[model samples]
Target: MLNIGVIGAGRMGLNHSRNLRQLDTIKLAGVYDILPEKATAYANEFGAKIYQSPEELINAKDIGLIIITSPTYCHIEALRIALDAHKPIFCEKPLCRTQEELDELIPLITNYDNFFALGFVRRYSPNFAKMKEVVDSGELGKLLCGEIRCLHGRYVRMHGDWFADYDKCGGVMLDMLAHHVDLQNHLIGEAESIYAQSFMLNQNEDELPFDYVSATARFKNGFISNIQCSWLRNAPSDTEMTICGDKASITFSDSKGLLLTKGGKTEKIPVDEAALNIHKIQGGMYAEEMAYIVDAVINGKKPLAGAKEAIDAMTFCFGMMTSAETGELVKF
Candidate 1:
């Protein structure tokens, strides 16, 4: 069994631990967090060792792999520590929140000796996979412009949480839209330029923090995408994406499976949700993702989403933020 240590005992950390346990070849070696008290539940539930610090957990002899699920701001330091130890890593998305972190991280990630995977879990989702298959099959002919819509309710985890802080979370664009941005890059093509606008991450005293952003991207492969994401009050959480081509168009949703359209006729493509997500847990994509990373560690193979994709996705999303801030289009 491959022993995995985790940093950050927050929701994502615990979520990954639970899913890692579902795989027989994986062991929950240990976990660490700045707040030791927050990690007791993880230690007790998984019988994982409670580590004193991130340095300790990552450097443990028993840990063959490290998974960083820490908050966005905290990711860079832990990532560096893991790299120094030469351990294979599986870090959750939005690899780093700012330009400085990216500058320092890019060189290390590219030169790391061991496999490094980023958690763009949506890549492993069934509906999105089916969408890619149809798009690549050429039944859609020449791919054209597309649109991605990601909407969410206001930030509910408010009680002075880091997520409410724009500096820490990078708002909805960096935190939530990274997933769809990666999908757009993976399914569509490389983005050549982007123009975007947003609320600039403003919040009133004692009010829940919220943000909304819309970005238009022109791809190098001669296609365009309108990407929108939001965290607003009284809004129902939903995600939808559609890509149109000369022959047909395909649309997919987190809750609605997939659809194919041609000549004014639409067809629903069947997806095996239960079979695809056997664990049937929340963020079910993480289950397959955890297992895949373990295999990559064992075989010395690259993950479907690795350092290159992580950096590329972050570049595209961050460019959108820069455009929103400067009121200008960002070109790659």
Candidate 2:
């Protein structure tokens, strides 16, 4: 069995533990968090051990894989510790707060023959994957444009002060929209140029961070795309994407499943029963991603989403943040 150690017993971390418990091929060896109670809670519930420190978890002889769901700031050091041990790592997205950190860590990763996968769960969504296949197969007939709209109630402010801080979370663009940026790259291509606008509606003037953002970009493949993200909405949470092509259009909504429009006719694409089962939980993608990493480590295969793809997506996100601030098109 693949022994997995999870660092951070917070919401995402605990979810990982639960999923790992359900996978027969994997074992939840241990977990660690700065908060003793948090770690203890997960360990007791999952029947795994709790370590006093991240170092202990990393140095554990039985832990072949380390899943880092710690805060964004801790990602660099946490990943470094795992890399030094030559342990395979599956890190959460927005890898770090700055490009310089990624610059320093990229070399360390290149030096070791280790498996690394970033958590871009949307890529694992079967509906999105099938949409990509359709677009790539010429079935969609040369993608013309796409738009992704994601809106969630402003529960983030309730989490903590750090979440509302732009420097920490990189605002709505980096923290939330980064997923769509990665998805866009996965489906369309690298963005050539981007323009963005952002605001802080219903927030105090002293907030010093944006709560909503909308960006438009031109892709290298000659496709134009628009992305809208907001944490200020008071309505039911909704996320939807529409991709238009020469021959057809594909639409996906988090609430509704998938739909296809072609030749003046619209039809619902029947949801895959297996994929639906996988999408039932937040941990589904996490488990599948870890499984992919395990395969790569054991079989000498490449990860579904490698570091290069992650870096490209982050670059696009950072560029959008810059564009929003400068009111000008930023080119990659």
The number of the candidate with the highest lDDT is 1
Residue range 226-301, candidate 1, lDDT tens digits: 8888888888888899999999999987667698889999889998776566544445677877766777788788
lDDT of 1: 0.85
TM-score of 2: 0.89
Model 2: runs farther than 4 Å from truth?
110-112, 154-156, 200-210, 276-287, 294-299
lDDT of 2 by residue, 21-82 (tens): 66566788889888899888888888778888889999999998898988776788888889
lDDT for model 2 = 0.78
- Clash list (residue pairs), candidate 1: none
How many clashes show up in model 2? Answer: 0
| Candidate 1: residue 82 lDDT (0-100) | 95
Q: Give the number of the best model, judged by TM-score.
A: 1
